[model samples]
Target chain A: MLNCKQTTKLLSEKQDRPLSFRERVALRLHLIMCSGCTNYDRQMGFIRKACRRIGGDDAK
Target chain B: MNSERDGNTSKAAELWLQEAEIATLRRDMLRFAKLQLRDVATAEDAVQEALSAAYATRGRFAGRAQVKTWIFSILRNKIIDQIRSQTRHPTRSLTQDDGRNAEVGALFDDGGYWHKAARPADWGDPEAALGSEQFWVIFEICLNAMAENTARIFTMREFLGLETAEICTELGISENNCWVILHRARSRLRLCLEENWIKRG
Candidate 1:
């Protein structure tokens, strides 16, 4: 089980690069059991959504 | 491309902005400039200079819809000019000396768990928050509150849309350290936004 700290760092890194299959599996497994990290992930998504609006890159 | 430009020229020739529209656009450009230059007077000067340049070339612009983006790119160059002129030494390290380590450290505990007070709250209807001017005001405040170098790197990544590698090369920092800075910035920004904007709502 990845702890909150490791899981959060991975969440940020995944934005910059593709994660290995093992890393992705580990993250998915950890996320399934952790509400806190799950919320953190969702909040990160919200931030990116906000970024898209500011940059006007939301054509999709 | 030349033929395309010719077609655009014919279609776009009649799409010039009115004086009133330029006046309104100045406010948005000023807000963007103020964020980068961090000085209202200097920001105004940059925007003024860019607008003057824009007016000189306004006849050659593509179309009404793209004028906003076109003007922003011009303003971006002017802001960069201001940044270069004002800073005697612009580069800084991400791993040390920015003083964010202690702040980010405080968010986590000895065992790598979120500090009780640092746990995130649910930001309900954040899309609605986006429509609020106050939300952007809070965001600007949050961004300006970050360390200078951290904010610059973040702006480079988010506002300017520079890739991490390009940023690393330009800043002369390691890829690993660049990621660290970005992570630190994001963590602090999210926490600040959550506390001041979302939680209050």
Candidate 2:
């Protein structure tokens, strides 16, 4: 099982590239059991959205 | 009648150009350039060059993209040229430095879990942050606070949406090191936003 630190690292990495099937499965299982990691994932998504807005690249 | 209509059409085009608000466009271009170049003087030069290029080519703009988008693309090319020139000089490595190691250590415990105090808190209504100019002000400060190379990598990925391969090729770093730099940048930005903007009420 991926710990919080490892899971969060993977979560951040997903923003830059697609994850493999095995990596996705591991992350999914960890997120299911871990609320903290789940929240971390959501915040990461928020950051991506906020950055798109601030950078004005959302139109592109 | 045909000659008169042509004159009217030309007049409207002149009015449209007059309405483009060059000053605001320059400010926005400077903000983006500074973020990517991380140097005020270079960013100013890039924006100046881009604006002039835009003016010189205004007739070919064709109105396909937003005015801002068109200018931004020009500025993007300028930034790429700057990056290429810097790479040729090879002044420094883009890989992890000692300070980055300390930053990475602070986020993880010996057991490889998020350090208790370092874990992220729920940031309610992320849209609120997006809607406020004040939020972006703090966000820019946080971005500038990061290591220059790390900030460059992060902006290339997040702001420019460049692929990892492209970023590695441009910066002359390996794929693995690029990912590490991005991870560190994200972790630090997340914490900075949470403390400085999200948690402030």
True contacts kept of 2: 0.56
Pull out the clashing pairs in model 2: none
Model 1 per-residue lDDT at B173: 80
Residue B47 C-alpha lDDT in model 1: 85
lDDT tens digits by residue: candidate 1, B116-156: 77776767667787777899899889889988887777777
In CAPRI terms, model 1 is classed as medium
Write the residue-wise lDDT of candidate 2 on A1-60 in tens digits: 898888988998998889999999999999898777887899888878876654555452
Query: Model 2: which docking level applies?
Result: medium
On DockQ, the leading prediction is 2
lDDT of 1 by residue, A1-60 (tens): 677788888888777778999999999998898777787888877877776555434342
Q: Looking at candidate 1, what is the lDDT of residue B14?
A: 51
Worst 10 residues of 1 chain B by lDDT: B84-93
lDDT of 2 by residue, B76-193 (tens): 8788778767765446776647475676567778888777777777776777666677887888888988888788888878877788899888877888888888888888888788
Residue ranges of candidate 2 with Cα displaced over 4 Å: A58-60, B1-20, B89-91, B98-100
